[model samples]
Target: MSKRIQVTFTKEQWSMIEKFRGILGESDAELIRNIVLIWLSEKSIITTKIKKEMDDENGNRN
Candidate 1:
């Protein structure tokens, strides 16, 4: 299952995000998803399976 979210950012913050998005070649959704997944992984809130899946999606291996 998936959930939708609404986020509000200041103009400067949005500009930064836009800049990084362009440089990283990521769409808004992909950038936000990767950010959230990274946070979850850092906080140890995601399962090993999810971590593996995320790593695989990012073409990373450990």
Candidate 2:
């Protein structure tokens, strides 16, 4: 089950959304959902990289 939500985008964001629609030819909801999933995956990768760097620094500090 899914719920409907509303978003108000700035002009710049609206333009970008239109561009995305042109390339994807998907419904706005589908595009947003896919984008969020991809964004979360990228965030996870960056978080892992940062944790590795912190671990390396801590290992060197001792």
lDDT assessment of candidate 1? 0.80
**Which ten contiguous residues of candidate 2 have the minimum total lDDT?**
45-54
Measured by TM-score, the strongest candidate is 2
- How much lDDT does each candidate structure score? 0.80, 0.73
lDDT of 1 by residue, 7-62 (tens): 98899987877876855458887777777777887899998998799899899988
lDDT score, candidate 2: 0.73
Q: Where does candidate 1 clash, by residue pair?
A: none
Q: How would you encode candidate 2's per-residue C-alpha lDDT over 1-62 as one tens digit per residue?
A: 58788988899986887787745558888777666666876778547666678778789542
Clash count for each candidate, listed in order shown:
0, 0
